[model samples]
Target chain A: MNLLSIIKRFAYDLQGLTFYSFRLFGKILSRPMYLMETFEQMYFLGVGSLFLVVLTGVFAGQGMALQFSIELADFGSKNYLGRVMVIAITRELGPVLCGLMVAARVAAGITAEIGSMKSSEQIEALRAFGIDPIRKLAVPRFWALMVMLPVLTIVTDFVAIYGGYIIAVYIANISGAVYWTNVTAKLTLGNFIIGLSKPFIFAAIIAIISTYMGFSTVGGTRGVGRSTTESVVACSISILFINFLFTRLLVPQIQGLL
Target chain B: MIRFENVSFSYGKEPVLRDVSFHVKPGETVVVLGISGSGKSTILKLIAGLVQPDSGRVLINGHEMTTASEDEWSRVRPKIGFVFQGGALFDSMTVGENIGFTLIEHTDKTMDEIEVTVRETLRFLNLSEDLIDILPDSLSGGMQRRVSIGRAVAAVDPMIMLYDEPTTGLDPISTEAITELILKLQSVKGVSSIVVTHQITDAFEVTNHFIVLHDGVMVFDGPGEKLVQVQDERVQSFLAPFMQSVKNIPAVCPEE
Candidate 1:
């Protein structure tokens, strides 16, 4: 298939699964949900990804603090270091970097797991059993990623801000009061929200890309690998592209709104 | 009953199947025998609606495969049990869970009811109770096929069972077990079956009707014994590779 046709097919498949998933969710809510499966995925997709999120958060915050201090120090505006760090973390890099991390971790896992299942014909078997693979496989995962990534991004923002505070105040010898003052003064609700919205979009992209990759996998073992790799690469690329789109299109609107 | 009329499928510029037409009636096992890459599995996939034909039509019980709504297709999907060549049992679940999947999905039946069904299906396949609790990995090759068969028949006794290369990679004993299980599934479950195999022995033992696909076209369509009497040189050459693989058969080629 040509690239456009392939993408069109993928989009069609995604739309079909999305509709199917919502229908299954209606069934799920009517009866008992797969409580145990949801919980396990929450732990695996959300909780297990915490360490990487926090690790990336801490270092990212420290780097931002150091960079802002060094740049603004030359202009005798080092006192504004905390303001820059907080804004940077809360409104942009915090969510974006964490999203990239999750694209690597969570998105890759879902793709590989589901892709392997597809290749092994487990997915076919599920269909034979009257189970919609989209419901059993895709929906639980999409819901997990959708709910978890945003929460994880929030935690990442907080952790990054704290890391910046420790580095700017203790290591850079900036006054703690000045740091807190600028941060409390400049960081606003609008900034927080602009940052928060990116992860929701990123989570959706991750869900779409991973589920698409998983469901479309052909061949056998090698195809699963290709799908997993494609999920991560496609997700990371799409995240960056979406980040730019949000920054260009939404950030200025928020600034105007505020 | 499943019917195909002038069905054609192609990937990109190349055609995999062309002008294929056939009907599989209830309670008959139809074996599609072909060389590797002959599109035998593709036929099964088309019947299951996993892939659409580029031209013509496929019907299950007189219902068009192409025009069915998603919910309608989902209902149709359960009636078609597919045992993939690889067994395709979910590795994440235990044998019990794999077999119980259909019950869990379509019905509001209790876990107790589901478990009873799973157990009875397993027992019918002559598998022991110990195999139920273990994961699919712990089972032998033959046992996995049996478990997959059990899972295939778990919830809705399918109107049609499709076996994709049922004896592709198995020891003689395992192959025999699979063949017997294939027979049992057809006879007891009372479902029409389509088995895809390169093995002539498997085709002979497991089918009454046979369709030999060559270059994605149906070359022979008749009773199983009629396949042996065909005067076609190409068919004889195709049958040559698998002939020596059969064990303990008489010298008579075949006579109906």
Candidate 2:
């Protein structure tokens, strides 16, 4: 394709995404909510992702702490490792890492599920019965992700702190009291808010991007696989890029509040 | 109940339907016979408001579907039942859930009431109640089609029914079963229908009025008996291979 065609296709895709996002938002706010499906998705997207998110958090925390201890030891400031670890994990790693994991697991699954439904004509069947597929499928998943991602981020934040604590006290030979004091002293309420809020944006990105990919799927099973791959890649990259944007936009404002 | 007046539709630039026009009146069963890619299924999709024509009009129960808004389309959709070629049952849902999906989503009916209605609908479609809780993947192809029909008729008695190749790949017995079901739905339930199929025998079995689409044009439109008698070379060549078998069975076109 030529540059003009490529640009035109990109514009078309952007327009499609914007329209789909608006429809999703409208359906979500409409009456006769599918509470049963929404709660089911909450269990699936939130509680179902607990083990994976926890595993990611623990390893990421331990890895960051180990790297920080090695670097700080050069300056005889190994005692400050806990403070740095907690701040980094809570302010950035906790939300982004958790978002990435959920994006891979939950977002890909949502895309595959809905993509298969589209391929099999089940989505069209929903329409044949006067049921909007977005309302029935996307809305529940969207609401569930929005509600659950922050909760999961909070869980990851605490778990990562404990993981850091384990590494600081045992591996680095820092006093447990000093580590706890530094960890608690470094983080403010603004940091917590920033960390928790990132997942909300990430959740929206994952839900909308994944659902959009699924809905646009064609060509049966192969199309479903392509959609799943596209959803994961798009959501993962979007989360990373948006993380930087959010930090740049929100961090200064949050620091000002403190 | 369904009318297509000078409708023309295309996929991007390649036209699929070209100024095709036909009407299916209440209690009438019209079968659209065409080779693959002749835009047979497009007609059903247009009637279901799943696809809009590029020009002219598609009317379902006198409502102009081409210009209708989303809410307006939704209001008209329930009045028509569409049975997709592949059954299109929700794979994640059980047979009962698939059949009762519309009721559970749209109606104020209690679970007990829904279950009762589901059971009755299944009975009407000749499906066993024991298969209710099983997922659609576990069912046979023919069984899945039956469940699809059950789902279509479960919510409300639709005024119009559109079937997109209801029996494409099936055994002779299964094909007969589906044709019988289509006939029963028309004679018993008084549901108007537009069936799109390439199966000549099946079309002859179910439809009263027949229309042939070749190269996106309606080449023939008359009674099922007249389909075999069409002078158009394309229609003749299309039916020449099936003429021997089709001739064995007596034509049974219902009186208008």
Q: How accurate is candidate 2 locally (lDDT)?
A: 0.89
Q: Write candidate 1's Cα lDDT for A1-258 as tens digits.
A: 899999998788668657744654465444335666766877888999999999989888988888888889899999898888878887788888989999999878988988888888788766655566766676667678778999999889888888888988888889889988988887788887898889888987787778768887888899999889978988999899999999999899988988
If scored against the real structure, what TM-score would every candidate get? 0.88, 0.97
DockQ of 2: 0.83
Q: What is the Cα-based lDDT of residue B176 in candidate 1?
A: 88
Give me the chain B TM-score of candidate 2: 0.97
User: Count of backbone clashes for each model?
Assistant: 0, 0
For model 1, what is the error of residue A11's alpha carbon versus the real structure, in angstroms, after optimal superposition?
13
**DockQ list for all candidates:** 0.55, 0.83
The Cα error of candidate 2 at residue B99, in Å, is 1.1
TM-score per model (chain B): 0.93, 0.97
lDDT for A200 (candidate 2): 93
Candidate 2: tens digits of C-alpha lDDT, residues B1-256: 7888999999999999999988888889888998999999989888887888999998877878889998898778877888999999999999999899888887899989999999999899888999889999999999999999999889888888889999999888888889999999998999998899999888877865889999899999988667777789999989998988888545454555
Highest lDDT: which candidate?
Answer: 2
Model 2's CAPRI class is high
